[model samples]
Target chain A: MTSVADTLDVLDQAGKWRAAGKGVALATVIVTWGSSPRPVGSRLAIDDGGNMVGSVSGGCIEGAVVKEALAAISDGKPRLLDFGVTDEQAWDVGLACGGKVQVFVEKVE
Target chain B: MKLDTLHALATARTARQPVVRATRLADGAEALIYADRTEGALSTDGAIVAAARRALADGRSTTVEIAGGMVFLHTQTPASRLIVVGAVHIAQALAPMASMLEFDVTVIDPRRSFASDARFPAVRVLQDWPDDGLNAVGVDAATAVVTLTHDPKLDDPALEVALRSEAFYVGSLGSKRTHAKRRERLLAAGITDAQFARIQGPVGLSIGAKSPAEIAVSILAQIIEVRARRAEALQAAA
Candidate 1:
């Protein structure tokens, strides 16, 4: 679980990125099932160029979430993405422990 | 993405104030709410603000149904604070352990030799009288005050202040007999039975703690127990 201070730090960075005219996307763990690495309410912020801060899955599904976050930034739309061990490619994405996480990615305007 | 709201939240976090961030799930509208006031524009309704305030008091994040939509209230509290009222041997062990547990620790002692940076390298050491030092730090519900000095001159004054404060935990190191005598003295000094009951005499969980380090562990365990129980109660209420 991310500490409250760490979540605030990510939010502060997102604000800074938005102020700097950089497109920013915020991905938050909205739900978790089984033995997910990160708990619900963890957040990750991604800038236009894929620069990111914080973690939603403790390295288990950050890459996938960041990809979706960058996509949300470009499309200027929100996306709810779910990843779990049931997927065929789960081992490649590091979620092979029967855990599932639902992330909400939204553009920070 | 409101910079003003984020900045205000950051400032509150820096000031160690309990605050909550309420975000509308549908549109992502955000607001910063404290006990008495709110910043930004999530909603102007009193119900939303009141829910946010309740979340802040509970110290937990939860999704609450409001009039128009569901809002997620993320409550943030300052780091837990531990104020050791004596720069003693047990403090030497306790400070680091508490720091590792994310407590902002302060060790106070009137004796300069004991309350030196040399003794507590990375901790805040205050060279002042016990009451004066605690007064300067200011205890609240998030703070735990531990008096390690057995001296009545130091520990008694510190206890007098701590028992009256809103600190979640107030503990003093002494034997049962010592605590009984100390209790008599405090009663003579006008401390009531109810107020004196708030203190954890013998200072720690009875886990056969012998060494200073072991005693520190026991004390920290007891503090954690109290803290966890409080959180559970709050969760139940929420």
Candidate 2:
């Protein structure tokens, strides 16, 4: 889950998105393996308009996850997604070791 | 923001999202519109609003901050559940403690007398065999499984299933002698030494706890400690 500070920041962002009439989905990392940057409980919130908040899987794969979350909301299908940053491309997400993560993204509705 | 009613209405519209409202409990709370609001109290309005805004923005959980005190608004995000495969005395106490920690606790036992609601009023007590109940609930990393029944017939099959699942913490309550027997049985069942290590036999902390409540406390303490350590390690790795 995101921190109180981070949660508030994302909520503020979500509020703005809501005022602008954007649909938002929240993604939470429920599990991780092998030197993952973020804890299993880390969270990320993405709006239908592509605005984002929170992080899961450190910085390695949040971009991709956010895209998936936005798409899930638009499509009205919640999904559990997984991504891995391997040692060969460890620097791709600025991760040192090969780490894999599983995230659950669902629409608030 | 000065209009509590307007602010409450605005927040209620977005209540579907995990929202936390930090309001000044000591002062400046006159602007708080919802008397039904779950509050995070802070000393000042600035700090309270800042904290409340932060919790709202994250859409993960909520926190309310007061100057000297902070009340965290934990929006009820679904957390992992825990299933105990025994209705032993320790399970009686452990179930409630686990529930208090926010785990959806369920106890399974084939003995109707052992798994009664009166014994564990707060927990979901099921008078069924282990495998059936666990399969129904679906154990995973989010779920913690513990076998408190010393009987091999009760614990063995349940443990076998738990070993195959992604349950983060799988422990059994027993003595050294019982664990040795269990190890031998697991080996016969094709479990490797590595997999055998997965079971936290002789469950609970090293603290010498004699009573059922004490044992429950120790066991829950270990779970909390392990979870906290895992979170820290993940953060450091990040």
Candidate 3:
């Protein structure tokens, strides 16, 4: 319920940010496999100023997603990012439960 | 995401309408897919729209490899709800538990004291008559209704309303003998046997639950089982 409401908030605020001349990027978790903190379709929105709403993997990988989302907002390029426990940097930002998540970060036009 | 697509999503959310946003992974092309209409760059793709419909029904996001490219269908559906018709002792245990499980829970009873916010600290409490409370809440396919009041006067009205609505689950707490008597009364009130059969009597799974908390656990488990079975059947048919 909180996730759904969070997404609703993201959509609503994204529109406001876009209208107010602020760049915004939306990141969505498209795939999740095993023990993921958030389910598939969870979202996180990042503004040009680094403000964020909603979550993709709760707290596990949001920092990385926000970084990529800010880059997407800057470059106007969409990115399909993947994070798993198997990655070399997994120790730094990997899921504690060893789940895999695929996120699509796209600039909101 | 285009401005119009975002607006359409906000519109769909407000209406509680199911939606799927299908994104082509090859390019960043996306489409807002509703049952009757579509918008965005890839709106003309029939295969993607069909897949989107399937994902919407399944209430799951999926990645499908189509002929041209892989597409991710992200689905959004209304939240599931739980309506406890009697703010009784069992409901005191059930309401918060259901809320914790992410069901929008509401406790309804004509007795003000029973349905007070003090009784149900977190869940919504409605002191309206059972039927009126149900009407105010508005039952839907994503909703589950449970009649926890053992009194026929209170439970039967709620049961009659629930049995007629599109609520996915309807259960009433009572003994076998009490259920038999209730069945007769409902039958006399013009409720068909088919409709009456929808009520799960002596509510909750027979897990030898002794206390109110255990009974609440059993009931919630049964609701989850029923919903999962229904979803499996729907997906199989689809």
For lDDT, the strongest prediction is: 3
Error of model 2, residue A60, in angstroms = 39
- For all predicted structures, in order, the TM-scores are 0.76, 0.51, 0.75
Ranking by lDDT: 3, 1, 2
- What local lDDT does model 3 show for residue A85? 84
Q: Considering the two chains of model 1, state its CAPRI-style docking category.
A: incorrect
Best of the two (1, 2) by DockQ: 1
In candidate 2, the second chain superimposes onto the true chain B with a TM-score of 0.69
The 10-residue segment of model 3 chain B with minimum total lDDT is B39-48
Worst 10 residues of 1 chain B by lDDT: B1-10
Regions of model 3 farther than 4 Å from truth: A1-24, A33-38, A46-54, A89-92, A96-99, B65-68, B87-129, B132-138, B174-181, B187-197, B204-221
The TM-score that candidate 3 achieves is 0.75
lDDT of 1 by residue, B1-238 (tens): 4556667767887699888877776777788888777777777478877777776777766677888776777777897899999899999999988877768789999999899988888778899999999999999888999999899999999999998899999999999999999999999988899999999998999999999999999999999999999889878977
Which predicted model would earn the best DockQ? 3
Backbone clashes in model 3, listed as residue pairs: none
Q: Write the per-residue lDDT of candidate 3 for residues B1-238, one digit (tens) a residue.
A: 8777888888887677888888887667888888898877874467788878878877889998888777889897876889998889999889878876767788999898787887787777889888899999999999999999898888888888989998999999999999999999999988899999999888999999989999999999999998889888888887
Tell me how far the alpha carbon of residue B34 in candidate 3 is from the true structure, in angstroms, after superposition.
Answer: 1.6
Q: For candidate 1, lDDT tens digit of each residue in A25-60?
A: 988876678998876678898998898888888687
A16, model 3: CA deviation in Å? 7.6
